[model samples]
Target: MPQITMSAPMSKFSSFNVHDDFVYKNVDGVAIKTAILVPKSLKPGKKAPVLVHMHGGGFMTGNRLFEPWFALWFMQWAESVGAVIVSPDHRLLPESSSEDMADDIVDFWSWVHTDLSAEVSRVTSGATQVDLENIAVGGESAGQYSFRAQLSITNHEIGGFLSVLSALTCPNAKIKAVVCQYGPLDYEVPWFTQPNHQRSIMGAPPAEPGKPEAVIQDYLTRYVDVEKIAVRTESRVEELWPLCVAYAHAGKLAEALGRSDKVMPMRLIEKAESLPPIWFVHGSGDTIVNPDCTMNFVNKVKKLLPQTPMHVSMEPGEHGFDGGVPLDEKWVQDGLSQTAAMSSKPGEQFEVRQTSTTEDYTPDPSKSLPLSPERQALVDDILALYSCQPTIRRVERYTADCVYDDQFVYANDRYKMAGQWFALPKFFKESKNERYEIIKNDRDLIQFKNEQSWTFKLIPKTATINAIVSLSLDPDTVDSDFIQVKYHKDQANDKDYSHNGFGFQFKKFQADNVVKLMSSDEVKYFEKDKHAAKEPVKKYGTGDETGQAPKQDF
Candidate 1:
């Protein structure tokens, strides 16, 4: 593979203002420094989201200024969002032990909460303030010598990033999202512990054509006498990049990085409490770290915390595949679409530059309001009621005598409302609130327009309903709660339209299906007898059966 050389990040983002060499922490007399890049479009006093990026240098070299290793799409996305970029230069390996690097990560979080705002304010000349609420941590591969190090691919970043999740002492520092590209995050995988014959760097022959194990031993012997060499100049760092891959090829990577349990994030992942939305991109053809690392990490995260939204973008190319490309590629645009989907949450939007493939959605700016805590909770509950969230409780949100009429099913009380609502999943596998607009919210009435879809469980067809609703508050509890929907009239939005054949048909079909699926037997979760023999779940494919059945049956 040919070397992908990229232009300076400053030149690409020319409109961005910069501040170089700001010290964030002092560790054992070493002043850990960081570089800040502020977008010019960010106006004065306006809040800006932050992107904390850790540079990739195999945990052995490269400062935070190593822009070539940065992902092209992510940087451009950050620029489009007017994000303040903070790239820290942490302690490198051989110079610092695994514990030291982990400490640096812990300290980095503390610095982010206490001093990051003022530091950014000074950097951008008070043009923008850091929005601590909306923060993302991202890094390119710096793990595995072949370009799979994540925190970017090396043990330093893997340990460091995990340290933030598992060992972080700071309460105020929270990361809303994470973006990792081509990382070997799992140390227990055979790739890190087992030796490999292919000593090539991204399919290129090694500098020394000898056996990988011999080459690794030779390199280890040379560095054995050297004490810690923390920070190096740029050119030297570049030279050291390819050289680090030898240890990984010979299966000495973990041992070389002090062989500490801290380097293994697989051990730490289960301990993470607050999981953030993670975005992972890997080159399918990557010879260094390989895509399995990313897939494994994503699978583990999903298994541990399935609710955390994750997007794994796989492109065709070698490691650093997106080094010199622009942000318009299909993979990049797909990532942008995922970001757009994430924007539905109130303050967790990372709206990036979109390509032509993505559909534009322009919500009415007039309706946007800063809701109070109670009203926000009401909105959340209302959205949850429609979104088919697993955790929704109808009794907690709706009034005892609330009326719900969708033409097919009618309920005059919260008890019946829950029965009809819970019956939704029996007909459809998924129910989603596609587009919602609150028409009115007051003491007497609360009204909204909702466009939603229900996907059939057995068929491939999907039904979209254009529903308009008006809510009447209960007089007794309305003042105390401010949102007790005593009556909810689900009106059809398309009935009055001049030509609504398409819309009316969808509503009719979905409503009819709901009525068909509403029998208590189909939705047995709300009512099931413990003594009754369980219904046998139908198997889709032909299979052998071994489980027991009661002998009383005829």
Candidate 2:
């Protein structure tokens, strides 16, 4: 067992008292350090739930305090929700594999259950003040992956990717829930295998095996013996070669990598049938670990355990929702509130502050004249129609416009248009014309130049004359070629728009098309539907003798 060390001294906050220490003599004889965060104020004879949290960093980097932001926020939540949090500093990569990390957690759980039986009883009995049955496990990134391994063992699966099989199979049946933040579920998925796994295994191209420039070989040489490095290199060929072949043949190498037979079988999910309920938090714009990972797992779980409670929150941002990212505070609170609600007993009280507000304001006629009754009614009608729609208005720039001459427009090989967009002009200017910036802030100026003026037509289905025609520009100068579009729809529009009655109608058209490109899926749907020609006629009910329907219009 590895020895435990606490570098930072424990500090007491208003809501919680944080203590850092090591848990020695782990099950695998590896000593690991852990941190315990206990809520400071608790009512006498009242026990709080326990949450075991793991941090992210792809399982390779990260410590018990890997993400201090989440730690602080979670501590605040624990105080408000009355929960106890335990975060352990597990063994990391290069020194250990993900299995080793999972084993460390299992060992810690055992120690908490058996070795510290007195403390456990004290906490549960409200002497030390911690709830026993309401235990939950959670983590972010690689920590999340390891947490899944723990869940897998609790559900009983043997021998696959990592060596934690022996440790995981011993059921710690007390755990109530599991939460993952942007964790990778399917290791065999192409998104996880190809490019990513390959790069991690063999390093990048132009740095071949046994060569001085080979990064993979260098990394291996630093970590393992020559014999082990040779074995790992050979193993890479055995694992990734078939994956590459599948990718070439199916155009779905990512999905292929995720297939159960390729790496870790998808049957693991089935084995996890009796597992506790799960909560998944992912960023909508996450590219590192595709949101598809969560979507696929959730879909499979829903089929296997329809009654198992699962809540997924898609934040309007990208991976690493800790700091410096646009995270939804409301979404986080809602998730915490849900967790608290689920953990509480029948009559137990759990209070979460809801900050959503509705405004009631009177229009000022002095600043702007009030509209006529008829105009006001028209405005009301428009608002009523769009009230259910999810509208997002943000400034974005037109980075490229591909247009061809009349003769070349019909030519198969004729160039259409393709260009890059950036988030800031300062980056473009700093890059010295190598790249152009798109939209960073609303205050930033946009530049648009006509590389070739082309006619564009956009017709709405509801109204034939509701068409938009604009002169699209092409890339001429790096910094001087940008146009601002006030509104852009994210991929979730279909899901959000479903409430507005338009989402289901447009759902089929949203597939395989980037939000910016319309001619692909957009044109295909347009050609099939032909707008108003397929519109359903509105039916009106007969009115009563009083000249109104039995159900009067509000």
Cα shift from native, residue 512, model 1 (Å): 13
Q: What are the Cα lDDT values of the candidates?
A: 0.56, 0.36
Candidate 2 lDDT over residue span 185-289, tens digit each:
644455655443223211123223333324333444676534442111011112223223223233233342234321332456566545455667776765445
Model 1 residue runs over 4 Å out of place are 1-10, 141-172, 206-235, 339-554
Question: What overall lDDT, based on C-alpha atoms, would model 2 receive against the true structure?
Answer: 0.36
For TM-score, the strongest prediction is 1
- Kindly list the per-residue Cα lDDT of model 1 for residues 1-554, writing each as its tens digit: 00112343545446567788887777657688888888776656657778887776656666776555556665666665667888777676654666776667777777888899998877666767888877777766232333433213332233224323322233356776667767666655677677775655565554444466665565556754457543432234435654566666766666656645555556566766646666677778776665777787678878986876677788887766776565556566545445333322311011111111212222243574445465656666776777676332443355433445454544443445556566656668888887666656665555565677889899998888765555665432233323445555664522211112444445435533553455553234222111111122222221112112111100
Query: Could you tell me the TM-score of candidate 2?
Result: 0.45
